[model samples]
Target chain A: MAHLTYFNGRGRGEVIRMMLAAAKIPFTETFLTERQPFEKLIQDGLLPFKQVPLLKIDDMELVQTGAIVRYVAKKGGMYGADDKEATMIDMYYEASRDFYSKFLPVLFMKTEEQAVKDAKAAGEDKYFPALEKRLKETGSGYLLGTSLTMADVGFLEVLLLCVEFGGDDFLDDHSDVKQYYQRLVATPLMAEFLKSPFRKRKNDEQYIKEVKRVLNRE
Target chain B: MAHLTYFNGRGRGEVIRMMLAAAKIPFTETFLTERQPFEKLIQDGLLPFKQVPLLKIDDMELVQTGAIVRYVAKKGGMYGADDKEATMIDMYYEASRDFYSKFLPVLFMKTEEQAVKDAKAAGEDKYFPALEKRLKETGSGYLLGTSLTMADVGFLEVLLLCVEFGGDDFLDDHSDVKQYYQRLVATPLMAEFLKSPFRKRKNDEQYIKEVKRVLNRE
Candidate 1:
């Protein structure tokens, strides 16, 4: 069985978990509530980059969230069909990452008002229009082909965050993305996994405080 | 031939160019001397994320440096031969990125003293030992298999930056990496490519000031 180590929240780790769920891959978890365990993992030399979420699989421990997620996606046959399609899938995945990178930073640095403003601006100016255009252009309801690839998986994750920070009406303006998001969430695999007992909770004040305290950032 | 658009500096644009050189990919470059051309590209919908280092290939415009670099590596046979190898190659590539992200940020915001300290710490504590360990383990002088892969390419790029920021004796203690770096530099393809007239200069004050002025940052 594959194992994952991280905090008990939907930060970077959740996306990997979601990919596992999408692929129906069984995996275990090590949810560290504090910093000591994380430090110990580094001390034990299990983590090359001294970070999590680390995935232990195929007798190798992988760090770097992007590497881990892509590996899982590749192994699960979600990467794409060929080199060109794979590149496109990677491009879309990276596009979502850029959106999340710009949209979510303010949440850690300042007020909710500012965070919302940043999210809206990032979505409106950068991601929303381009993605809507691509989705409409595809007309297949999926980002690439007729089925769900890591491209859609990554986009769904960001879209969920967008709606959370910007509101449901966030996608209301981008009807194509809204319909695509709905279609992805309605997939039987995703629908069931969203309610799984192992599904982690949303990041909250307590979780943030606990993690920051452990990392000595507080 | 593919087309690349970016500033005439080895900042974010160089690595992609290096991968192209390594794979012997024939591509033309559009070196943006000012911000006007960059904004024009974005305005013309050529840049998806409102950024440069965009590559026009396969009749599609690709953004995101990582995606573009990986695509080139994949096409050039530098991305490992299989999925597992590809994952390791990506892990190594990302490790180098992590090193650069930490090592270079200080140059833009603070003193050279602090930048050196951060670069040394980032290299020694994080990248150095792990990479040395892996290199010795592989015994191939490559990050993955017996031949040059994207992992080695990525590391060589960072090692060049590491030498620039840390100095000649930086890799002295890491004997394996030092020798490997020397071997990569001596390669026939790379040796000739390094002297190409099209190679961009390293980032400097004039380039930075020109970019900022054009972008209205000042």
Candidate 2:
């Protein structure tokens, strides 16, 4: 069985959860809601880097988000058909992930300044258009190749959260991305997971407090 | 032919260069000394996300440092012998890389304050101790397995840089890591590469200025 330990929110852990859901893999979770328990886990040598989103599977405890994600993706056969294709998948995944990181702060803090908001919103066109260009260039109905891979999964995962942060019309400038996002969601696995109970909620003020409590920013 | 394009300094490009060198693979390089030429390359659509350390190999223009490193590791037969081993390699590599990132700002500007200096130095004990624990647990002389892999290579790479930044005695607290570092360096492949002209220089004031110019920090 796969078990996940993180906070009550979906910061770094959601993507791993989504990958599990999409693969129809059943997993349990433990939420570390306070600093003491988090410190205890670290003290117990459970976390490799004293960070969370730790997954215990195959009789091994895994930390590092990138490593856990790769293990899950490869296990689900979502890496790619071959090495060259896998390289492209990784490139797409990394690019999408880099773009996703810009919006991560939204989960913990609310920015009211228009300048900060504008600067954050500015990343959409700056990064997504290149993704738009790739979708148009590939014409394969996938990011790099025909079959669905972690690249597509990662891209769709980030796009959904970007929409959550940027609103329904977030992809207004990215027609191809919008279309691709829809196409990915309609896949049977994703369609099921989207409606499943494991789907985490978008952040709210209450949840932000919850996350802040876990972050324990003094 | 394997071709690399980056700025004159090592920065992000040196690891890929080392991996190639360790495998006795030869490659040519193109250096971009100015921002306009970089933007021009982006305009030409050679870069996936308008970044450097672009490697043209196997007829693919690869970007993303993590992805490029993965490809090179796999091709050089240094990834590991199997899936579980590769996962461990990924973990060690990502952890070491994360630790390396905290020191990257040293390349762009001078950090003179003792507090910042103290904080940077603090990371060595926080991180390398965990790595030392891993080394002791494995007892393979390598990081994860009995044979040398990217895990060892990446750890050594970061340790070398950390030593350059921190000093020769940086690993005095990490006897296992210190011993492992020496072991990796003494390997025939790494020993030769260490003496080769390809070994990049550490960041100096002039190199920092060069990097700042390429970064175009105004």
Candidate 3:
């Protein structure tokens, strides 16, 4: 049995949870609800790299969200079919991360309006178009092929997060991305997971409040 | 034959070059010397993510520095020895990337001094100690056991960059990390590559100039 630990947020842990659910793998999620215990875990040297989303299999504990997701994807057989597909999957995963890197910092910025504006612009102008083109070229099923892979799940998580930040119109110009996102959510396991209370438990209130404070000042 | 393309810089392409060299594999490094041609390549659809460090194997082109390094590492047989080692390698790779994430943005900030100070502090307080502990426990001479892997290569790149930013006395407190740095540089292929003109070809003039400007202001 795998024991996965993270904060009570969907920030980095959502994809891991989705991958486990998609693979029908059973794992216990230990959510750190506050900073005190998290600091204690760090002091105890239980948290490798002083971070969460650490995955423990028996005795081995692994850190780095990207590493954890890729490891889980490999174990779940959702990595990719071959070298080419894997390369594509890797490329897409990095693209999603690149997308997030643009906007995530904005939540803590003093110039939240300008930062949010830039993030939205980049998302609409660059990321969405690239995603739309890729999905169209590959067909509407998944990021790579007819079968689901980690890229699709990871990409969807990024899209959902950006959409939450950018609002519904985020995908209006890119129908393919919108449709592809719908396809991912409608997948049997994901459909069930999306409706679960787990999906609504995004503990990004601190970040959200900060962004709101900056925006209100603006 | 593999063809790697990037600026004259070791910014993101050095690891790929090092991996190929360490594995005794042959590859052609295509350095983009000018902005015009590089922009043209992006416009020509030559760059998938509109970024360089694109690895072209035969006809297929792959982008993203992380993806390229991992792929080249895989091809060069430097990924890892087993599944567990691979996970450890992955974890370390992401940790190295996380280290970069903290400092890289500092280069572009108005509060560059404070940012660099924080980055240097974290490098000393968090990253360096963790690395020293890992090195002592593994006793592998590398991050993994007995043989070199991508984690060492990637982590070395991060260390070199942070050391560059953190100044000469940065490693004074962490003798183990200092020794490890010397050890990696002494690896035959890495030693040769380090002394080569290739290592000095860092052509990120725009970024370097900007960082210098902000530091001068302080």
Cα lDDT tens digits, model 2, B1-218, are 79988877788887888788765667888877767878788888987677788999989899988888889888888888877888889888888777777666665545734433653564554666777788789888887777667777777777776677677876787687788888988989888878876777766676666556776864
Ranking of all candidate structures by their TM-score, best first:
1, 2, 3
Q: What is the TM-score of each candidate against the true structure?
A: 0.92, 0.90, 0.87
Report the C-alpha lDDT of model 3 over B1-218, residue by residue, as the tens digit: 78887766566677678776776666777766656667677678777566667878746888887777777777767878666777889888888877776766653444667777877777776788789888988997788887778888877777776667777777788889888887887888888877876564433556455333422432
Every candidate's lDDT: 0.80, 0.77, 0.73
Rank ordering of all candidates by lDDT, starting from the highest? 1, 2, 3
Model 2 regions lying over 4 Å from their true place: A110-126, A204-217, B110-125, B205-216
Docking quality (DockQ) of candidate 2: 0.66
State which docking tier applies to candidate 2: medium
Give candidate 1 regions above 4 Å deviation. A106-109, A213-218, B58-60, B107-109, B213-218
The residue-by-residue lDDT of candidate 3 on A81-184, one tens digit each, is: 76677778888888888777676665444465676677777777667777877877887477787778888887777777667667787778778888888888
1 versus 3: better TM-score goes to: 1
Check candidate 2 and list the clashing pairs.
Answer: none
TM-score of candidate 3 on Cα atoms, chains taken together: 0.87
**Candidate 3 displacement at residue A47 in angstroms:** 1.9
* Per-prediction backbone clash count: 0, 0, 0
DockQ score of the complex predicted as candidate 1: 0.72
lDDT of 2 at B58: 89
